[model samples]
Target: EGLEELSKHCFDYAVIDEVHHAQAPSYRKVLARLNASFVLGLTATPERTDGVDAVALFDDILAWQATIGDGINEGSLVPFHYVGLKDDVDFQQIPWRNGHFDIAVLEQRVENSARMAKLWMAWRMHFGSRTIVFCCSQRHALFTRNWLRDRGVKAAAVFAGTGSDPRGESLRALVSGKLDAICAVDLFNEGVDLPDVDRVVMLRPTESKIVFLQQLGRGLRAAENKSRLIIIDFIGTPAIRTSDHSSPLIARRRMQ
Candidate 1:
């Protein structure tokens, strides 16, 4: 009965924002009782953080596959830079969660501080005119934005929770280059296209192949002098060799 209130009057379509958070007690109950005739579910961070279940409980499924090499070999996307940040840097000691970097601890140790400012400034000098930086936390993203803006680089920042109106506004600014740089956490990974983006900075490191692939994809859209995509890998990435990086990352590297 309470769920029906959401369906009052006429509604053509419905979209459930983040199914990853579906298990929240109240949300689980609401989603369990949903009676919508047509519904679409969406999420990026889908797996359970607790390890209870690795798969989503959706009623239907479809899948697609594309390789990083295929995209670049075909001239559809740009190449990547396989970089590793300083090993003994105080920033590298941040916490980790599963295959992802823990944002809270990383923010405290590295993201929103003087050390991070220096790192980003170096990158800004290297890729001055066109670039998109993939960041770790919301605070990290915004801090990079303000720091670069203060330095007169025309930078911007956005996150998953920025709401609809502002999301569109900020995105437009980035694509049009009215905003020279946009720092973000998880939103700019896939299903979003920014062809003019010539460079990418991975200020955060992730152990997941899917994540590295998605982040690299953002700059793969073909463009002018889009000759190479820049990736700054700060962590040691012990088991993962630079040559064995995301297919996009591997495919992007100049065969030397």
Candidate 2:
């Protein structure tokens, strides 16, 4: 209704933030109806996992481009200390379809007690004041949260349709220092600001560079007393690699 009302007015200039989502059906419909002399779309991530060309909406004109390395050097974002650990899970056994692993089978493989125990040890080794653990699924997030909780860590899981705590409440607890960490599945990947998040634990394999950067950006926001972000990535043997020439870290890790 709001978009419909706005569409009635012809504007000289229009700006769309987070334009990476401009390819969505709803966005496409609204954009088609919007009458503007000049439409400017802005997004930190122009490359999308869905293979939609976000810049095509803007006539394929790229105004500017900045890599994560640029942000760090410019002091707009904090630097990161990356630590990559090897996971024992055999991703080769899991079936891959539609550009990613089968979620159901991947979830089962990732929930191993031995893997969780190793992750716990790594977390203890490089503990941070506030942390976010990215899991493969809701069940994986819950299992990680419970495992940490049982070990006397204040942690919680947040995902779609979560019944225990609201997303906002969990975020507040994390910000206020009530919770040490949050184990999340697809919730904090983008459009969330967590400046104080000092640590990010990668508990799942990421096959998209866009998603990898989005998750990394969650902790890269400049915050008071935050010198640098800590990234703990667990790499599986058969992990798919995504490469971006602009980002040396991403290119080297193939963390797409």
Instruction: Give the whole-model CA lDDT for all candidates, comma-separated.
Output: 0.62, 0.83
What is the TM-score (0 to 1) of candidate 1? 0.63
Instruction: Give model 1 RMSD, 1 decimal.
Output: 6.2
Residues 1-256, candidate 1, lDDT per residue (tens digit)? 7767644544455567655556668777776666666656665435444543313555445243345666677888766665444533353465557755666776766544555655665575556356777877788788777777877877777786652226677778877777788888788876687777777777765555446666766777778766776665555433243223342344322211
Can you give the lDDT of residue 228 in candidate 1?
70
The lDDT, on a scale of 0 to 1, for candidate 2 is: 0.83
Model 1: pairs clashing at backbone N, Cα or C within 3 Å: 79-252, 80-252
Ten-residue stretch with the least lDDT total in model 2: 247-256
What lDDT would candidate 1 get against the real structure? 0.62
Candidate 2 lDDT over residue span 39-139, tens digit each: 88888788778899899988889888877788878887888877677788888899998988999999999888888877777778776899999988888
